[model samples]
Target chain A: MSTSKFVRQGFPLWLLAGLLTACTTTTVDEFRQGETGIESHEAIVILGRRQGSTYETREEFVNCVGERVSRGSGAIRVIPEKEFVDSLFPWFEPRTAPLRTSDLQALMEEQVVADKIEEYGVRYIVWVDGQTETTNRTGSISCAVGPGGGGCFGFGSWEDDSNFDARVWDVSSFANVGTISTDATGQSYVPAVVVPIPLIARVEANACSSLATQLQQFVNGD
Target chain B: MFAVTGNRKTTATRSLRVLAVLGMLALLSACGASSLVVEGSYPTPAVRKIPLSLGLYLDENLRNFLYIEYTETGAEEYRVSSGQTHVQMFSNLLPAMFERVQVLESMDDAAAAGVDAVFAPSIEEFQLALPQKTRLDSYEVWVKYNMRLLGPDGAYIADWVLTSYGKTPMEGLLSVEGGINEATVSALRDLASNFTLSFGAVPEVRDWLASRQNVVSNQ
Candidate 1:
């Protein structure tokens, strides 16, 4: 059988192999361990995510950072997305008009940090950017395909991988504080919508914990 | 003929398998899509009432008759001016306050018609205090208002004072019309809501009247 024909015939072995190869191994040791280079800052201001139709999960990452920073000696603050937008450009309402990335970057550089320095007595700022991707694999067994080709034992498996990347910036000296990447995968089998196979939750939790731990290390300097 | 029939059956089976697989993919995608979730929460004041119209005078400069200009800083001046105009178009769109005031007045009128009580007009004054070093361009508005209840005795029954402030940063530009107008409107809405809550919570008038009637009966 021709390879293309084989692929068309629902043989996903090659695709699965490629995805497996693409998965990178990350270890605790691979992550930078200490904050030896970090300076003692008076405050930490968490940046809001970019504006879009959908809500961004960066706020979760921000809360994680805020939790970690509060344990340290620094005063932790979150600039309300509205206040930040108003104080920075005061012109572009993100609610109505989507802010361009370039414009956002410029506002971050010129308005946010400058005003924080002046009004909030902020000496240091922590800026975080986050993005997530997801993939899922499913299998089923059926005696016969139902309406619209629905059935089980027409065994099908799908594999999906999403990448979550976050970067933290230090405002005082305008340096990158740290960066983190995480991946989450999920899989399910048909005939039982109730049972999730339990791995999907574990995968997502592991990704969240890994990101949080990386940020904590940055905050702790350990 | 038999061989051709077998080939046709095999093809049908394979097609069925492909269709089943696609259905499974669709179900899986739907499940995964529904799993991502986000939530938000905001802090709300436990009690939102400020009592009104026991009077306190502000400096004459802070009175409502002053004309002010609004200005913008940096590159944002243009876009924000447009945004301000958009916001200003509906500046008086809060009809709820007027509705509530009308309802309250009607209730008071009914009460007076029954000779149970008399209704008196309440006075509200908003004041703005410019920060020292007048060149600094800081603006803060203070609002005060009072309400009193009078019965057949023509005596003061109850009263209270309400005050709140709104502040804006100092920009060198000399226009307060557009800039302070937005802030002032927002502050006034909040003030009105607070006043309504306080007015709804008045117990002193009813309690004092009850106590005085009891004393007269006992004597």
Candidate 2:
């Protein structure tokens, strides 16, 4: 069977996989330990962004990775985007590309920012950006309700794929350390009886976990 | 009645334990608040001795033993007076490394002491960076010094500035003050060692000391 046809046929099984895997499996495509040589056990910020929409998506992914980086990896601290941006760029807020290496260098030159960095001993900044979308959809669902009796039922399936890249930068040296990329793909199903029951594949969550793990590994020289 | 007596014993035991814990915490805090005096001396290096009067221009801040209290607002005003400054520490360290070194309080003292040359050392900067839970696993301390070698006639011989850093891993359960002081001691030790090595190794200093020795011999 063609790959697309097979994926369409395996919608139920994919939903089952989603139910079984509390955290979807993560696949890492690229993990380059950059040359900055920053210590792993230092505070690093995780930021997320996308070309369209606001910073909501970035915040969600940053929270996810920040939690895992602190808990799973032996990282001394993982700074979330909210804290990083709120403290550093309180007035102007854009996670993806507003701040560059030169901008950071200039900030570091400021006495206040320099003092803060020295106090916290921050080492690295990890910038994450990506998109997760429904790649394919198949089957159909329908529902109907009458005044005497109300009933609705439908069955449908869709495939979701998440792609994200994380770039690590050293705070002191103001240099890029490395990059980590992750791709997570899963199929979901929706069964509508009286109400719609959707089994959603945790594509974003899987990508976050994988990217965080790889970033930690890259920093710790693992 | 027996049950009541047993309960009373248990209550007494628990109370005693709580008291002991509180006492220990109190003791820890008291000790943590105290300033640290650097103890011990580095072994004199194997080198020719230079007889000179050393003038110490100690910064007022370095005169007090300093420690840090890791707080939300960062470390502030935790200093203790120990009757000695970092200059005095250097004074204590120099006698061992040099053949004959006299601590001169002023240029007048150097002139009266009939010393060929004088060395003036001043603290440029001092910082004790305490470790934080989410930020750092190691404590680091930094010290910078601006030094000048001058003749008793108030003529400058040479000038040099040196910055040294020391770091140590944060270990055990103790007060932030204690941890920072330990790291500071390490940094001071390294700074002293570097100073001694540089003092003897610098070409200009070596020549100057050698010339002073030759002048003394001729006289």
Candidate 3:
């Protein structure tokens, strides 16, 4: 191909590549120490801290982490957030309030709670807490609903940042073992011209994977 | 002047091509989706004192979107919202059905938890659908699950797969979002019921339980 022809073809390809790269930007951070004494056969229950009407946990983020932890950590089983609630909600309901590790011991003292724990063979309970928010936004987009379907026009951009922390508590000892956290930020852009093109960063998903991997490593003590 | 005109034409052509490519991509990506939480409890068999360890392995896609197929355009896209994720559905509902079930967060935790055996579930095929172009219609969700059973020693006991379906009618009075949530609730309930029905009947699981019982008796 002529140099001019090559330039014409290569330019768009480069631009496309750049756009794709910009879309997938994510940072995963974690820390851990020696074997935390958790065994492979034990169970870790991930719970969401309730905040009034809503829970502190994000459904997508929790599930993502649970899936990754199960897959990444060999055969290590993860007690999903849903199961955690099903198993523990009854005890929690009495309080009509949120629970901290401090409250578990007293509850554990109860025969029913203790029996349930032993029955379930729960080793550690992980509490996930955090939220994702739009940190910043600049630009505007407008839409018009016409008889012929509908359309949006203009350009809009927003930045979403997610901050989450995973706290591990050993059920047997009723002690807090360690904590892992993730802070992921994603930017979204919408360019509307008859249609809107959205570029979503998936920051929460990144946070999920990061937290899950780190929690696995922390529990495995590897 | 001729050379200048030729370069301008090339530039314009390149710009148009770029715009065309972007436009196509945008059009293809027009589908919108949302996620919902699946909530509810299902009836399980009688309580067994011997605790069973349960593990869930969800497909990453299930955590992301609900796949909806448009009949008009013959286009398939992951564009349904869910209140609860696939992981949440299994994790939350499974324990309710069983009396002495331990839902492990990680496989490593299972060994220490003193579980006799483990159940690992993975998604095979999952889809949620409603008639295309109609805001008011019944919504349906279906899933195929691939399951694996392992002993405490990590021995592979059994591998099986099961499919389940759920449906809910959309009331015209409710908003579109509300209808979607109702559908999700129904789908989750059916999936949980299906799990209890099939999982209890698995021979490998029975064998494993018997073996575990023997070990307990000896101890």
Question: What is candidate 2's lDDT per residue for A74-159, written digit by digit as tens?
Answer: 66487666555535432113322345677778656656556655666678877788877676798778777788877568788878
> For residues B51-155, what per-residue lDDT tens digits would candidate 2 score against the true structure?
654554344555554544444555433553322636555765677556567666556677777666777766667766666643766676777878788887778
A1-222 in candidate 1: lDDT tens per residue? 998897889977867654443233333222342242343434445554444433344545556545554554432444444444334322232232213334334544544335545575444344444444434555554455456664333444444443455555554444454556666654422333333222223333445556556655664466
- In candidate 1, which residue ranges exceed 4 Å CA deviation? A1-41, A48-61, A68-113, A121-127, A140-162, A186-199, B1-219
lDDT (10s digit) by residue, model 3, range A124-186 = 877777878776788888888978889888987888888888888887776777778788887
Tens-digit lDDT string for candidate 3 (B16-76): 9999999998876675333344444433322233354554434344455454544465654
Docking class of 2: incorrect
- Share of reference contacts kept by candidate 3: 0.00
lDDT of 2: 0.66
- Where model 3 places Cα greater than 4 Å from the true spot, the runs are A1-35, A52-55, A73-75, A93-98, A143-152, B1-219
Could you arrange the candidates by lDDT from highest to lowest? 2, 3, 1
- The DockQ figures for the candidates are 0.02, 0.01, 0.02
Better of 1 and 2 by lDDT: 2
Query: Which whole-number lDDT from 0 to 100 does residue B196 have in model 2?
Result: 56
